[model samples]
Target: MDQETLPPNKRELLKQISSPHNPKEESLGSSSHKPSPKPFWSPLSLQMSIQEYELLKEDDEQCLRKYRKQCMREMHERLSFGPRFNGVHELDSGEAFLEVIEKEHRLTVVVVHIYKAGVKGCEVLDRCLDCLAAQYPSVKFCRINAAVSGAGEHFSDNVLPAVLVYKAGEMLGNFLAITQHFSDEFLATDVEAFLTEYGLLPEKDFRAAGDEADVE
Candidate 1:
């Protein structure tokens, strides 16, 4: 084909005219054009700036959904290896307490073991369980009543609402100090501070908790 109609072999001609024998410029051309491969650590990455996290976190619903999934995964893992709490099971003579009281962790669990005796029993247990589940993953939180525990056999239908915390099966502290009408704020915040005082819990572990993995 005539030169006018022919397509140019740009690389070849550039090589020829630029002196293919010249080592530096040809290498520069090659090196400058080729993209670099990404590093391997990206799959487990935290290269994002705080500004980026704050920006993305603006979508509260999506952020919350992501967090919930992460928490469920961690909870499922704990429950799989061992029955972490008795909330979902039939309690058997403090057998549940055996696991609940023991901490395979560096710290102890300062808990408020509530009994199921009233209309608000579930609400109380749920709020505490979910709160501890998400925010205090390090500490165990449990609820057992006069029906299924060794302690319940004695106080079964006799005791007033109480708050208790134990460390190594020895009562570290308590606030049996509550009466019929009490503030939820005091229950939550006070116990949080108490746990922190004994070094049994983190002030907040929600961020430390794993991202919601698959619950199942």
Candidate 2:
């Protein structure tokens, strides 16, 4: 077909078909080098991502706080040098009672229960002291029978359940006939409350409390 004799549209089409195929001149849409469309971020999707990040961060902070508390508790236990006793000691003689009061740590609070067997409240008081001893390790709890205390005449049956609080070998409290302060049937907590009222008991040891909580 002669170019001059063909229709204008046909001549144009023929020109396009005969043109050299230059890769660089390809249509913009067909080019593979076009920068990828900027990633579309929807408002709702962005908000959800932010919320997730905040939740994760909060959890991390809580974990860190618990870890720090545990570390502090452990450090406190390691650094403490105070004497710890878990149960009441039964003194065989008055000299043994004196030794405990004088030889224990200066910071120790010594609670001596001068009790006599078969007394109305002596047995109950002894049981209460046992419970307190387990709770307050820093406090030295001891029991001595009135007959063996070398002062049986002074601590008669009327004062058979006397309690003597000592610190550094000095008596801080002298409660004779201590059973008068409690009901006939009492618990360890009642005894603790009574002593606390007079400021006779020391503050609860933090390390011991933490250990108990862990156990629970």
Model 1 lDDT, residue 171, Cα: 65
- Stretches of candidate 1 exceeding 4 Å from the true structure: 1-92, 102-106, 110-112, 119-122, 156-160, 177-181, 184-200, 206-216
Poorly placed runs, candidate 2 (over 4 Å)? 1-70, 74-81
Tens-digit lDDT string for candidate 1 (1-216): 344554568655654776745576566776546578978666335555655777777877677877776777676656544323322233355777666556434245546554656734345544655555556554556556646666754553335345566666666655442333345444555545555676656445434334333232
* Number of the top TM-score candidate: 2
lDDT digits (tens) for residues 86-125 of candidate 2: 7999999989988998888877899999988789998888
Q: What is the lDDT of residue 130 in candidate 1?
A: 59
Model 2's TM-score against the true structure: 0.65
Q: What are the lDDT figures for the candidates, one per model?
A: 0.54, 0.85
**For all candidates, what are the clash counts?**
6, 0
